[model samples]
Target: MPELPEAETIARALAGILPGRVIRSVTVLREDVVAGSAPQFGAALRGKRFSEVGRRGKNVVLVLEDATRVVVNLGMTGRLVPGPGPGVPPASTHPAVLFHLDGGACVAYDDVRRFGRLRQLSRAEWTRWSRQLGPEPLSRSFTGRRMRGILSGSRAPVRSLLLDQRRIAGTGNIYAVEALWSARIHPRAPSNQIGDAGAVRLHRALRRVLRAAVGAGGTTLRNYRAPNGNEGLFQRRLHAYGREGRPCHRCRTPIERVVFGGRSAFFCPRCQPC
Candidate 1:
């Protein structure tokens, strides 16, 4: 589950390798892995030079010389890495698509579950889709007051609200669980009932955890790694996520797990009281 931190790490890695590299050819290994006609997708990107690489929420943004934006939503188990060449075996694993660059370097897109998608969009299309997502949590505009407003009208569980991309972008299950735990808030607490102080605490915790994770190259629980094939070190510093039976670092209370909305949330029962 590559959340904002994972996506940010990938975008940073790509930024170092992709920009100014001209695409000589594109090979789509799995037709279903991409949106629309895979052939057309490849043709559109061929001969285009990468102008920039960045992230919007949890998606990786690739800006091309022609102003076409290639957005990759690495749903669940997707990865993008720069490799040697198409003829050479990938350093990490086989790829779904390969973008052969001018100097024999290549960029590979790999997704084990095939849930991720690669889409080519015009500037107008990118702007429209981006507007539909909530504010980037790491942005300066996403203040505690803004977070309170987002939760004030919702009756959904706080954890669910955190996972809602339309309500708060870039947070998936892992970061949501960690943020809630860090704030000492119960996952089942009603969003509208969290009050202003609690919202501020949650907001601060979210930003802290996300920044720390990004600095550490994101968490690599499984099937996640930087483009350089280095696993994230943040997973070792996690406080609550995936620590159901483990002791809480802050409190000696055993961490607990609960399932709702088809996802599991981990927390410390005593520290995050209902």
Candidate 2:
């Protein structure tokens, strides 16, 4: 799964190769790969120049010279070939679409599960959708006070609150557990119970965890990679997550795991007391 860090890494990696590049052809290998009619989707982007490529939350955004913007959501297994393109990955790669450039190079979207979504949006439309997203955790607007305010009076568990995209965009299962552990907060603690000091600690922990992960390329548990096909190195540095029953890195206490919201939550019981 390409969460915010993965998506952000991809955007930066692709920006080095995509911008100013002219599209020679667009091949929507699957009808569903492109949002609307595959033919129409290709026609709109073909021959256009890529002005900018970026990320908003977990979405990869492409700004065309003609002002048409394309947003790609890598649902579960969607992967993009950066730079000079991936000639042709193995058949098991599940290639979904292709973007051929003016040169012989080409980029492709390979999705094993086909859960990703692609959308074409005008400036106004894209802005409208962006407005729906909550404050980016990395942005200056998302401070500890803001985080506390968002969590105030919420009946949801702190873990569920962290997973909420509307409160903090880009934080998913992996980072949420890790951040909670780093903050020494129980995963199932009530959001309302996280007092002022706890809120500050949680906010700082979240930002620190995300920044470090992004800098290290991101955590690759499954199908994640940078646009250039580089696997993330952060998994090796993870303090929690996927470490169930293993000794905690700091406390030597056995890390416990729980199933919530269809995902596993890993934490050191002694470090993060209820």
Model 2: which residue pairs collide?
none
The residue-by-residue lDDT of candidate 1 on 1-274, one tens digit each, is 7899999999998998889999999999988888899999999988999999999899999999888999999988899977755456456464788888887887789888888999999889999998989999999999999999999989999999998889988999989999999999999999999999999999999999999999999999889988888999999989999998999999889999999999999999899998
Per-prediction TM-score to the true structure, in the order listed: 0.97, 0.94
Off by over 4 Å in 2: 83-92
How does model 2 score by TM-score?
0.94
Q: Which model scores highest in lDDT?
A: 1
Clashing pairs in 1: none
**For residues 1-274, could you state the per-residue lDDT of candidate 2 as single tens digits?**
7888898888888888889988888888877867878888888888999999988888899899877898999999888874343454333357788788876667888888899988888888898988887789999988889999987869788999888877778888989999999999999999998899999999999999999999988889988877767899889988889998899999999999988777788989899987
